[model samples]
Target: MIEVYTDGAANGDPGPSGAGIFIKKGKNNYHYAYPLGILSNHEAEFFAVIQALELCRKEFPEEILSFRSDSKLVVDVIEKGFTKNQKFLPLLQKIQEEAAHFSFFFIKWIPEKQNFHADKLSKKAIHLNKS
Candidate 1:
């Protein structure tokens, strides 16, 4: 099983945003930072998960994925497989599509303190937008 920790951050609401993903497979670790132009915090959070799943599809296909995120909205929306917010519908669809590539996919909400690695990466990504 592969463990994935994801986080997203924006300087302001609908401001420059980024997605960070930290992956652990056996004794190896991987990190990814995606600068997402401009998006809301919630949108960025969703994007982080999407990015992580996409990476898994290419690097760890057919592997069981256990995802952790500090965003409750993203986790709940993904677990329920539904969302009334129009902004998230397309994002959710993309997640579903990417998730299908894996045999097993799971997402859980974790405390911010427990997601330090991804959190730091996301903050770093936000700075990337300036450079």
Candidate 2:
């Protein structure tokens, strides 16, 4: 199965932000980072998941996906039928809708400390976006 782990960071809740994702399949692994213009941290988290799904669709079209994220809001909305806060409801719904395009997909919640790689990249992404 193709595996993906993602995370996002913001200097402040409504500050400059970024996202990072790590994708792996067997021995192959790849990482991506993106600058997010001013936005909330939660939005960045949502964006990371969106970006990961898009990349997975493009690069691993034939494989099943097992996705993981450290954000509870993201994982719960996607996997557990948790209703998002109204502010996030549309975004969550949109992500869920897009995920349906995948042949197979699953999401699991992970603690922030266990998501080191993604955290590192997201921090780097913040720095990169600054310059």
Candidate 3:
């Protein structure tokens, strides 16, 4: 099973943002922090999952994937397969598409404390983007 931890942060509600992804498969681990220029926090969160899914598709296609995130909104939206917020429709669609590539995909909401690694990576990306 491939385990993925993801997080996103923004300087403001709709400000500079970044996505952090940590992937673990057996004894291997990978970390990625990407600056997303400017976007809302929710957008950043969705992008983080999108980016992570893309990576999984490239590196671990057809593998069982378990995604963990600190954002309940993202987890809930994906689990429900829909969202009332029209702004996130495109993102939701993208997520669904990406998820279809895997033989098995699961997403869970974790507490912020349990998501420190990805959270820290996201903050570091924000700082890097500022420079």
Candidate 4:
């Protein structure tokens, strides 16, 4: 199974943001980052998971995906079947629908320190997108 780790970072509540993803299979490592505009940290966190899944769909299709993230919102929403914020219901539903295309999917929450690599990538993404 391939393990994919994702995280998001923001400078403030509604500030410069980014999404980071790192995928590991065997000894191979893959990393990606995408800049996000002004939004709540929670929104960026959800975007990170979506971005990670999209990457997997394109690059690692048909493979077993074991996804991990430092965001409690991302992990709990998908894994524990917790209720999502009402504002995000539509997006949450869309993401869930798209995920059906995957052969396998799993999400876990990890400690913040363990997610530093992705955190750095996310911060870099925000910098790259600065105008």
Of the candidates shown, which would achieve the greatest TM-score relative to the real structure? 1
When 2 and 3 are scored with TM-score, the better candidate is 3
* Per-residue alpha-carbon lDDT of candidate 1 for residues 3-76, written as tens digits (9 for 90 to 100): 99999999899899999999999999999998988989998899999889888998899789999999999999
lDDT of 2 by residue, 1-131 (tens): 88899998899888989989988889988888888878799988988888888787788877788888999888877776557388677777777876888888888998988788888888788888878
Which ranges in model 4 have alpha carbons more than 4 Å from their true place? 82-84
lDDT of 3 by residue, 36-92 (tens): 889899999999999999989998897899999999999999999999899999999
Candidate 4, residue 70: Cα displacement in angstroms equals 1.1
**After superposition on all CA atoms, how large is the RMSD of candidate 2?**
1.5
Residues 1-131, model 4: lDDT tens digits = 89988888887998989998888999999889899888678888888888888888888888898888888877878775546478566557666865787878888899989888788888888886685
State every prediction's TM-score relative to the real structure: 0.97, 0.91, 0.96, 0.92
Assess each prediction's global lDDT (C-alpha) against the native. 0.93, 0.84, 0.93, 0.82
Clashes of each: 0, 0, 0, 0
Question: Which structure is stronger by TM-score: 1 or 4?
Answer: 1
User: Could you arrange the candidates by lDDT from highest to lowest?
Assistant: 3, 1, 2, 4
For model 4, give the 10-residue run with minimal summed lDDT.
80-89
